[model samples]
Target: MSLSKLGITGSEKDYQLWISSAEKKTSYPLTGHEHPYGIKMSCIPATGLLQQQLEGSTSASALQEAFLEGPQELQDQFILKPRHSARNQARKQQGKVSDKKTVRKSSLKNWAFGCISRTREVNEHPCLPPTKTKQLFGAPLEDVCDNDTLPTPILDMLSFINHKGPFTEGIFRKSGSIKSCRALKKKLNCGDTVNLNDVPIFVISSVLKDFLRNIQGSIFSASLYDKWLDVIDQGNDEDKIKATQRLLDQLPRANVVFLRYLFAVLRNIEQHSSSNQMTAYNLSVCITPSMLCLSNSGSSENFTKQISFIQFLIENCLKIFGEDITCLFGETSVSSDNSNITDITDNSEKVAGM
Candidate 1:
């Protein structure tokens, strides 16, 4: 029942793994965890959604109908499965089993294939849209994996940090820009208690880390970033094609294809920076180090080049995930052992002006 036992006081590494795995729909048991009924250990759900998809109920066309007609609560309950898992499960249920051993082998093969597809989907389209071209998958926007849109406030803050923005020159004008908390509160139309940390910086940081991890296969690997940086530096036709092929091999086809177009747009932005009254270098620097954890370099120039691609990533994310990307932030209330982890969004209905 202790906080330490629940992993609140665990080593920073363990805490991060626990969190990242949770995002991937993997379970981690919290020993000595307290439930409302009594003192007991608890395991996280095997799937991100609390409920399972009903038989023949989660198809793209079906999901779209449900989204249009179903209640918000119902929408929240629906779970989207990877295409590979769905196909394999269908095959297993339909195929004839010759023997117990054969069935076991089939199951093992299906599991392995399913895992490969799952990893591919995550790495390629960590923020894929519910619908591809004509059908919808009914994915929920509450979870970071399923959700793609950056919150307006977070976008504002990022713009603030970068100086130049997707839309504006940001909160700071020129260089030295400081305002009192009171002045900021009034300007931003926030309460006295609101601070920079009050924004969901942690959640945004976590999402960025997850995205990078999926693409690179491991956040600890410097080689992946270095290779990417090399591509940026070289910028030759042959090198670009080779790098594009490599990424397409690793990522989802849709993502790879979309990114091609995205990069085109970014290139145009860089080329016509003078028209927009902002230099390409300045524009790039404002968005680098996509997340705090991925801050691998101290050089602004290098970070600037790296950030150009991520800008497209974030903008594309908005298209994939839809607009609502509300995440929980702030303190937890722990009056009892049975208490659930509190997110500020839990009370969103009651909290006005959020």
Candidate 2:
């Protein structure tokens, strides 16, 4: 049959036809001129008519039977089958997919642990001035002051500020010289006697800020930071104070003592707001960053609430933390001794210069 009869428009030379015999035989070239049954085709681009003819005619069925009975090489060329190696390769590809998924999970877990470790570093081991004693900057409160009191550097700085900072303009509001602050911190850390009289007032203030900021976990510990902000959401002053007092009670004794002492000093500064221009609100704003370990994820409103909480503590210095301060220090009375607080002055003398 002609190529046109096979519904193929190609030249006769473009196609090859083979006839499979019942008897095993070597291959033979196509004549391209005759139709034959039991013919196995190769390189035929159009198989639609060929398939239809095979299905519809008895002779085509005989051709298919002959094709199956022919040599194995003829069968291998015409048939498609899955190879054993191909299935094994598919299984290996599936294992690789599973390995990628495992790696992703492992990477995610490592990232989470890394975040946790960084947070712990910030909360537990802040960068601090080199010191010989374990009870100085960046030390835990329990280790630094088990008797429920401020650390040496903290009390010294607070005492100095209480003595001279009240009259200084922009006492805590102004930034101090960085070099001076570092020098003072090194002196204090080295257990050297530092007379507040010798250091510049601004540097003294900056050292105080640094001390608070670098304290382990901050004065308001990281665990209590959220509760402090929640105090601002209270409906009234009484409720807020009540909430604050509850939170204060939850603090370690050293933190409570330091807070009371620090606020008392700040309260003294607020009393001289006319001269220093640092009111309770301004003092709160000045020291809030140092006193709290604020997270970068916190909103501005949360910061505002923290400042409000601190401002409340300053304004009511005697009311909120007063009794605890009294119990801890064994004071006979509640007094704002700006010139000579007994505990602070006594401690100051140990580190004070001639």
Which candidate leads in lDDT? 2
- TM-score of decoy 2: 0.55
lDDT of 2 by residue, 155-186 (tens): 76777677667777799888778988888888
Off by over 4 Å in 2: 1-135, 323-354
Write one digit per residue (lDDT tens) for candidate 1, span 63-151. 33332233332211222233354456446643432221111111323321122112212333355567633111111212212123322
Query: What is the Å distance of residue 188 in model 2 from its true position?
Result: 1.3
In order, what is each prediction's RMSD in angstroms? 24.3, 24.0
Best by TM-score: 2
Cα lDDT listed for each candidate: 0.33, 0.61
After superposition, candidate 1 runs with Cα above 4 Å error: 1-167, 170-223, 233-235, 252-272, 291-354
Model 1 pairs in collision: none
